[model samples]
Target: MKIATYNVNGVNGRLPVLLRWLDEAAPDIVCLQELKAPQEKFPEQAITDAGYNAIWHGQKSWNGVAILSRGLEIEEVMRGLPGDEEDTQSRYIEAKIAGLRVGCLYLPNGNPAPGPKLDYKMGWFERLKAHSAELLQLDEPVVLTGDYNVMPTELDVYKPERWVDDALFRPEVREAFHSLVAQGWTDAIRKLYPDQKIYTFWDYFRNAYGRDAGLRIDHFLLSPHLDKRLLAAGVNREVRGWEKTSDHAPVWIELTAGG
Candidate 1:
């Protein structure tokens, strides 16, 4: 089965581009982030017509997440991340599709760091780590996939030194990401192509895409059982170049069935 994750930026604004990619890629299941729309505003019919059933958690003009499954019923697992009752951002959604448990998330983009935003980001990371630890106990074929908004290592960014002050690449954030992985989750893309300069996001400014000034922020973390089934993984980098496309491209992983 092929499963993918994409941060659509805005589902309504980029529906056409998304539909095109869906037709072209035909992933069995997809986890989407950054819907940037209210619950009533989600273009459900358009997505349904594209041959997928979906469940989404949307907020007004900001963070949102969804899961779409082709030719299968999506059993809702949860809507938001646990451990923060006061946190109301629609950044997480989980579901069971095609025998796999999938968690889709759009982690906070804590820019202009050394402030409250960075604090929130770190706190969220801690919450996610606690929640992930619980999920690990399930020992099922699971995938935690989404735009983590983190450049995990020096190789994950185009210029590591230049992004030192950036929240996404800060040492604390990177260490948090590493600590999450150390909880027995495998970074699918990096595991598949360790030495390659793979990237999934690029800034729209300064001709970043043309210069390949990108970051590998989106990720798929597989449970040990699922990792064994991983057959292939990669970024659909060309999707970033399409007209009116999102800054993030799609990242995908193919797995053998019944692992």
Candidate 2:
């Protein structure tokens, strides 16, 4: 089976591009981030017409996430990160589909370091760590995939020195991501292409994509069992060149059956 993740940026504005990609790639399951729409605004019919059943968590003009499955029942597990009750951003959604536990998340961007945004980012990371430990204890095949908003290593960034102080590449943020993976999750893409420089996102300004200046922020972290089933992984790089497409390209992984 194939699973993919994409940050649509704005589901409504990019609906055409999204449908086109869905038609071309035909992944069995897809995780979408950055819907940037309210709950009622989700284009359910349009997505349904594309032959997928979906469940989504949406917030107005900001973060959102969804899971879509083709020809499989999507049994929703949860909608938000479990650690905080006061936290209400639509950044996470988990579901059980085809015997796999899938988590789709849009982690906080936490821009402008030395401020509250960075603080919130760290706090969210801590919550994620706590919740992730519980998931690990279940000993199930779990795939946590999405736009994490942090580049875990210099290797994941196009220009490490230029982004050293930026929120996404700050030393602490990278450490947090590293520590999270230390909890026994395999970074799937990195596992497959150890030394390769594969990127999933590119900036709109400065001709980032044209110049191949990009960041590998979208990822798939598989539980030990799922890691063993991993067969192939790659980015739909050409999709990034599509007109009005998101800054993020679709990233996917194929797994052996019977997980």
Candidate 3:
């Protein structure tokens, strides 16, 4: 089975590119972030016409997640993280497709750091860690995938020092991310391309994409069940160069089988 994750930036704005990639990549399951629309606003018929069944958690003009599968029934599991009831971002959605518990997360890109946003980012990480711990105990096939926003390591970024002050590359933020992987989640991309600096996002500024100056923030983490099933991992870079495209590309993995 082929599974993929993409930060679409906005579903409506990039619908064509998304559709094209979905056809070209042929991922059996696709997890999307930054839908940037309410649940009712999602183009249900359009997606269905393309032979996909989807489940989405959406908000107005920002932060939404969805899972799309071809000829598959999606069972919604959870909507928001478990840290604070007051925290109301549509950044997370869990679902079951083909008996694999999959989580699509748009982790906070806490900018202008050393402030409340950063604090919230760390807090959200804790919540994810707690939730992931519970899921890990299940010991079933699972995939935690999306634009995690935290760079897994310095090698994953272009200039580690330049990003030192940013939330995505900050030590504290990365540490919190590390805590999640420590709970028996396999960083699937790293497993395939350990030393290569494979980038999944390119800024829309200063010819970032043209120059190949990008970051590898998007990820796919598998549970122990996938460790043996892991077959391949990849980043679809050509999609990022399309007109009015998202900064992030699609990251994907293939498994030998799934229940």
Q: What lDDT score goes with residue 160 in model 3?
A: 81
For model 2, state the Cα shift of residue 258 in Å: 1.7
lDDT of 3 at 163: 86
lDDT of 3 by residue, 156-202 (tens): 99888888888899889888888899889899989888899899999
Better of 2 and 3 by TM-score: 2
Give lDDT for model 1. Answer: 0.94
TM-score of each: 0.99, 0.99, 0.98
Superposed by TM-score, candidate 1 places the C-alpha of residue 223 at a distance from the truth, in angstroms, of 0.4
Off by over 4 Å in 2: none
The positional error of residue 30 in candidate 2, measured at the CA in angstroms, is: 0.4
What lDDT tens digits, residue by residue, belong to model 2 across residues 65-134? Answer: 9999998999999999988899999999999998899999999999999689999999999988888888
Scanning candidate 1 in windows of ten residues, the lowest lDDT window is 133-142
Error of 2 at 51 (Å): 0.3
Question: On a 0 to 100 scale, what is the lDDT of residue 118 in model 1?
Answer: 92
User: What are the lDDT scores of the predictions, listed in order?
Assistant: 0.94, 0.94, 0.91
